[model samples]
Target: MVRARMSPRVRQLALIGLLLAGIGLVVIGIIDPGAPAVADVQPPAQPGTAKLAPHLFEGPDGPETLPLDGAFIANVWLQGCQDCMPSFEAWKRLYEAGEIPKSLPIVNIAYGEVDPAWAERYALHDTLLVDSDGSKLVKPQAITTFTTLVVAADRKIVWRGLPRDPGYLDQLKSALAALPKD
Candidate 1:
């Protein structure tokens, strides 16, 4: 049996409907592209977890390996990610708000082609570690996205994710409070 052909007006309406739906989706993505999806945070890495190799940066005199001997916040960023810039700004606000503890330092690990000049424009001039090898250090550390990791003194990944989540500041405060005295 032959199928009934739809009228020209009906087809045009359907096409317009599909186009509108696509535009809506684009708008939603622009409004709130959420955190990168990654596996559940693994258990705190053993004290002997492999460490990052030494790497060069704009200011340092030579290749310097990030010392793995203390708790720190690693904010991994990429030059191309649309969300990365805003995320950096958000973290900066948190830092300026004094939410970050005085004892814990925040470091930015530029995992890709992040120019030092461009990063500095975003106020990322301090404690920046350039890793142009595309996450060789972060991947081995089991980090799977552009988020922050709360690392323990022993180089263990104590906690990892967006600190903007509700109650996260409190959690961070508690974690820092619980760090073992050496």
Candidate 2:
């Protein structure tokens, strides 16, 4: 009796198929299936303001804290992204334009580890916080790479990056305008 062995080409093809399957699984695991469609706008949470959990900013260094009231601009970023630098640049433009409220704070949330000083310099003085809400705990809530949220006092997202990619500064303007003059 002779045993048939897979030819070299056949073996290579089988290996490639396995590799592709592994990659697919990785993609699925990272992306959320139940996320809301990008086309729909995020309604502002109202009646009561809910705090973004310290875990969201919790880190080995310390937990990042954000103001509970007023409009806020949070720049969500992944550490490796070369493009994320623009979000920081945009903040500068808004500050120079006087579009950003002087009193309100700017929160920069990095998806992975980042240089504290660099993030600060890039933020142009805005508060920088690492996203301690790593994949281990954080469930991706259906947002884009450059996703920015204008959180109302009630802790609900009043407006998000849509109808136009307003970048950072423009969003700051919209948030400022929405804030009441006390």
Candidate 3:
């Protein structure tokens, strides 16, 4: 049987193409590592009662177990998470404009190696809570890029969701209004 064999030049070109394709795949993986196979599971799917376990979170004045004796807004985020920054900025603006009640405390819970400068930069120096061990207060899988929880004095989560979610502002306003005045 007579068979046509690939020339040396053709064989070299094929090997080069395969090598280039492999390199391209590696570059793509490095650039965008994509989401995890298992998605994070958020807690208290709907607004419900849940307690904040006493956790030693580093603050401006060093570590302390925050006293949840009153209604407050908990802003949970991961360090170096770019998507979480906008939510923090929006909350800051609302607080500065007096849109958020002066009496309500906004606690910023950071999961990961906390950067001290972040507190000052975000104007959250007084309320920053650093969860250095990430999973102390809440499981790692439960904490997403950003999660906002409006908890009443009784440890009931009145509203919980992403800050960018639709009706977020309206729901937040309603939750604040529903909270008992001190």
TM-score of each: 0.60, 0.56, 0.67
Instruction: In angstroms, give how far residue 118 of model 1 lies from its true place.
Output: 3.3
lDDT of every predicted structure (CA atoms): 0.64, 0.56, 0.71
Candidate number of the best TM-score = 3
By lDDT, highest first, what's the ranking?
A: 3, 1, 2
Model 3 C-alpha RMSD to native = 6.0
lDDT of 3 by residue, 38-144 (tens): 44445444566566666778876888766658888887777667888777677666666766655577788877666768755655555788887666654633666
Q: Count the backbone clashes (under 3 Å) in each candidate.
A: 0, 2, 0
Quote the positional error of residue 48 for candidate 1 in Å: 12
- Candidate 1 stretches with Cα past 4 Å from truth are 1-60, 141-144
Cα error, residue 133 of model 1, in Å, equals 1.7
Lowest summed-lDDT stretch of 10 residues in model 1?
Answer: 35-44
Winner of 1 and 3 under TM-score: 3
Q: Write the per-residue lDDT of candidate 2 for residues 128-159, one digit (tens) a residue.
A: 66654444212344334545656655455555
Q: What's the true lDDT of residue 25 in model 3?
A: 76
Which residue pairs collide, candidate 3?
Answer: none
